[model samples]
Target chain A: MNYISASPALLPARAGVGFKPEHFGAIAADQQPLGFFEVHAENYMGAGGVPHAQLRFLRERYALSLHGVGLSIGSPEPLDRDHLARLRRLCALYQPESFSEHLAWSSHGGVYFNDLLPLPYTEETLAVVAAHVDETQTALGRRILIENPATYVRFSQSDIPETEFLTELTQRTGCGLLLDLNNVFVSARNHGESALGYLASFPLIAVGEIHLAGFFDASEAGAPLLIDSHGAQVADEVISLFEWTIEQAGPLPTLIEWDNDVPDWPLLLAEAMKAQDRLRHAERGYARRLDRRAL
Target chain B: MTSVMSGVAGDFAAALRDPLVTPPAMLSAHAAPAASTRFCVYRNNVAVSLIGALEARFPATRRLVGDEFFRAMARLYIKAQPPRSPLMMRYGDELPGFIARFEPAAEIVYLADIARLEAARTRAYHAADAEPLELSSLAALDPENFARLRLAPHPSLEIVESAFPIVTIWASCTGEAPLTAVEDWRCETALVARPRLEVEVRRAPPGAAAFLEALARGMSFGEAADSAAARAKDFDLALIIASLIGGGLLVPADGVKQMETIHGYLA
Candidate 1:
């Protein structure tokens, strides 16, 4: 059905904040125009409610994106057809500008773990993920963006790097990349890899969205390990990486996430305004480059 | 190959049931027992995530027991009752029943009801949205015929009866009401509803509770009022009716009437 296009026409590069229920009144009454708003798909999976109503209101004023965290794309068990159908229904109802999931699994056997869990980068896991992606696209009737996960530990038996694994998934299934830069910074720090190199390795041509969020330094045994808690301010280093991403891939629809100890709407909107500043600069840079090429 | 994959899937499933012991090392392709470690990670994530979901849905229950105690009980709960849905707000529907039979905290006989209140609050939060009936709609009706008329509760209303002063406990713990010196806390009933998007929980009169319960069971307004009056010296029909309507507990009967008279209309 192609509910979401691979080359979808995104809003002119700008920043948005996650749509939290607490800030709904402020966002509704405020005069600021955000580029869009992103929400955890599971939060709105209810048949109807305040969250649904709030999302319906916000959707009219701004572009909406549905980000899912518990699809368990790497599970060996068959995809939950009911969950897929619910996602399909939500897509039909909301018609979000973009839809995305993680490159990790959360459930196994039959039980669901709400957190995004890491998977081994191997042919078997790859095959499982590709099949799930195919099934999800078919069920959702649209292509999806798969976000790379932040990990605290790495499997000793991993055959492929995270970038290669994500690239392979995109190639085989024609999926797009959400390219969470803060995750790149977090996972890189946790595993002692260069964040810049990791960002450079991303297949940016397929990049559809960018997520910038805070991280917690939960180093175990004095060794630096970052937890993607999304609790605080976006680090300056990650913003630099975001800037580099803008230079490399041009500005995509970026999102600022603050899921824990959520601040007031103005605070979140201010953070989004920070990304909007960067996106505007990137947009002007791209325009100038295009003008120069014409000359 | 299909049979082999299914066997492997079954083995992995069994491993999840008891993941403490060392699993077979060949599950990972690079051969360092990464699958076991990954499985351990998955187990930890599931335990923590589901436990957190429960804690969020059952804060009053958590407060009744301390955080540490709640976490311990929740771990036991995760082992016994895994979530069936990814929509986490719906995860702990069976928890009240589970707490009733749970051995560790069974001494707190009222713990199950407290858990029921918490679960009801969670359900109310996620309940379907509806435009409430205006006060004038009832005002337009003849007072004589009001007793025969049925009032449909809003989609988000839930009533619970507890043997402990659960309303006091919840209010004190959530800081909704100022704390007072402890006395002999009496048994109480609770009414939960979401007139707006947020769910509200508060104590209810026994009469009102009984009335709402009957109405919830599809009783006519006259019968439910009679039931309410049986429980109290003065079940003020005006107060209860106004309260229910004001709290968005009552919906107009148009939809139900339309459904009931469908055959006649078709004829």
Candidate 2:
């Protein structure tokens, strides 16, 4: 099934925030300045209820994005056909501008761990992940953005840099990247690598969207590890990294994710406004470049 | 193929639940020997988040037991049976049954019933929406025909029949009412349903559960009411119908469901 919306089915190059039910009444009352609203696809998969009701209301006003966290696209097993069908139904009904999932696996052997577990970036995993992505794109009949996972451990499996692995997967499957800046900083700092170096190697041109969120510092560990706990505000370093990526990529559809310790409406809106500031700054740079080209 | 893929992913999964099993050789936490938080982080997120989902679903149950006691018991439940559904909202289907057998929570005899009430409410919140049977439709029916007509229960209708006053406990825990001692220590049946947007829960009248159960089993209104009245002499038919309308428990009549008895199916 396909749906053609009045607006283009693509995320605008502006800031968005994840939709939470608590802010439903607030968003309904005031027409906030936001590019889009993203919802975890699994949470709204029920047959009918307030979730559907609220999502329908949001879909009418905002450019919605169905962000999936449970597709398990990185798993070695075949994608859950039932889950893929549900995603298809959701996309058809909501007509979201964009849909995305993680580069990590959350389920294996019929048990879902509810966490984005890491994978070894070997030649074998690359093939498995690419094949899964191909199937997912085929199932949805549209491209998806795969977000990079924040990890505390590095796999000793085969020789493959994370950037090269992601680049090859995008090339093989013709999908886009989510480029979570917090994840890049978290994974790189944990492994004693440079976030700038990782971004330089990242496939920036194919980024359809970007994710900016906060992390918890497990500084007490043997080596510093940052947990991708989206509880607090976006860190200064991550906001800085997001600015750099916006400079390079020219303000893609950025989303502020405050899933944990979800703040009051004003706090969440403030977080989105923070990203909007960076995007507006990048927008000016793009317009200046275009004017220069016209000259 | 399963084994090949499982070789790495499977080993990693096995280690998540069991801390004794170290992170597979495929992982290196900063090249440190015998020291790292890699595996622990994943384990912690899985446990904490799953427990959090449980806590969200069974808040009244959690409030009844203190946070410390709830978390400790929830931890045991998580270890024994991790969620089968990827959807977190549907994660704790087996929890009420789990609580029924738990020794530590055994003393709070009504704890399991409260868990059941909460679980049913969660299901009702997500249950399929249907237009409820209008009260006028039933009033129009002839008294003779009304006895034979069977009403279809609403898709979201669920009843928790308990020996304790669990509805009061749940209402108190959820702040719907202040905590108060139950003057009557009689059995109670709680009906949970979502006819429209809101999910409503309240005490079901005497004999309503049996009547509804029989009605659900495809018994005619007359037969079900007869059984209920015979079992409970104080059964009031008007009150039962009123409760059904108020709770949106039944939709308009369709074909009467085929009755299934103990021995065989009845047409």
Candidate 3:
């Protein structure tokens, strides 16, 4: 099932803010050249209210994407049918340009843990995640994007590399990857690997979107630990890694996520501007490469 | 594969409920060095995030009980009552009821009510929207018919009557204050309403609480008046009607055709 917008959003490589209620009035009253606004699908789960009212007003002018944080896609349990139904309803109502979820589980047993928990990249877990993704795609009757998660620790029993696991997921389910370069940098640093290597190995052909967000460096002793908190500006190193990804994957619809202690709209847009610059640079580079090939 | 997934889900539930089951690994015999640590990270994240949800939803309660005891109680409550919905904002709706029966906080008798007020405020903040009736509609009605007409409160209106002075405690705890001492000897009533988009809570008068409570149940003006009278025979209908309308409680009755030139001797 391929999800395509009837009138697709013109996601220019420009700055955008995480659509929040705090900035609703500011966005509504002001005329800012924001690229697009992103919202968490679950936050607007309610039937009708001020949030919906605000979103309805904003949707007319802004290109919207529904990013989900707690779908528990990698859980071994059966997908929550009702939750998926609500998601489908949201998709039907908004007709958002893009939708994505993390390649992590937040629930075990019948209880939800609320945080995106990591999963071991064994064949067994891969098969489990693939089935869930298949079911989710079938339920929504549309293709969705999967994001890689940042982990504080790695499992010794895992067999496949994270990139290989993600590639296999896309190959089996035909869903695209919403690669977060920050998460790659975060997970690689914590687990002792090269972010560049991870970027090189990523299945660029299956990449649908890119995410650039801030991370916290919880480095202790001599080791530098990167935590994907999404609570600050995009780090310089992460941007460098993101540039490498764009050099490989070209210009994809990228997002700037700042969920905690969120700054004012202008500040967020400034950070997004930085991403837009990198994307434009990548696009120009791609154009030059094509021109050189013709010559 | 489905069966294996189900088995994992079962183990995951056990890991959250039974703290003794530390690692969430599928097989114990093949446990890796990273498995235990990763599982611990997952456990800590779950415990902390869920507890944070509870704290955000029930800040007054947390303030009352302090941090250490609050975290301990939150952990126990989370295991017993994991959220039934994916909507994180609605996660801790049952915390008030849980706090009421919580053995550790049994000594703080008012803690449960404070939690209830906080939860009510949260619900009111997210309740469905409705257009309020114009105040002129009420003024046009003849005072005699005011008692007979039905009054419809806003959908988000909630009246909570508690034995504890929850409003004063919540106000003090939320604001910087030379803390007003609540004479915990008497019961207090708090009325919550979303006049605009935000929820507002105010202390309700003795008879006013009864009047609004009855009206919230879809009672006619007369019935609500009688109910209020039963609670306090000296309940002044005029005062309540004026106050309720001023607070955006009643809406105009449909097809209330005004009679032009009532009993005019000569037009």
For all candidates in order, the CA lDDT equals 0.77, 0.84, 0.75
Evaluate model 2: give its TM-score: 0.93
- DockQ values, each candidate: 0.31, 0.44, 0.24
Q: What 10-residue stretch in candidate 3 chain B is worst by lDDT? A: B258-267
After best superposition, candidate 2 residue A22: deviation in angstroms? 1.0
* Per-residue lDDT over B6-122 for candidate 2, one digit per residue giving the tens place of the 0 to 100 score: 687888888887778877776676643232456778888898998899999999999989999999998999889887767888888889999999999999999999999999998
C-alpha positional error of residue B55 in candidate 3 after TM-score superposition, expressed in Å: 1.8
Tens digits of per-residue lDDT for model 2, A138-236: 888888888998987776664799999999987788788888999999888878789999999998887888888989987654556778898889999
Off by over 4 Å in 2: A1-9, B2-5, B31-35, B136-150, B219-223, B254-267
Instruction: For residues A1-295, write the lDDT of model 1, one tens digit per residue.
Output: 2233546336446788888888877878875668889999988876456777888898888888899987878676788887887788788888998889998766666776677866667777788888899889988877898998887555544678889888888888888888889999987776667999887787888888899999876554645656787889899999999998997767789999899889888788888988988888988898888899899
lDDT digits (tens) for residues B51-158 of candidate 1: 878888888789878899999888878778877668787899999998999888888778898899889887877666656666777786776677777677777778
Q: What is the Cα-based lDDT of residue B93 in candidate 2?
A: 82
Write candidate 3's Cα lDDT for A168-265 as tens digits. 99878888787888898887777777888988888877776778889876555655556677888888888898888788766767788888778997
Error of 3 at B73 (Å): 2.5
Pairs with steric clashes in candidate 3: A109-B9
Order of candidate numbers by lDDT, starting with the best:
2, 1, 3
Residue lDDT tens for model 3, B1-267: 455445665665577556798666553212232445445555676787788888888877898899889989998888789976667878888888999899889999989888888887877666655555666776877766767776666656677778877778888888834477776657777877776666788776659877867876768788888898899765887777566777775554331112112111111
Off by over 4 Å in 1: A1-11, A220-222, A264-266, B1-19, B22-48, B182-185, B207-210, B213-219, B223-239, B254-267
Candidate 3 chain A TM is: 0.93
Order of the predicted models by DockQ, top scorer first? 2, 1, 3
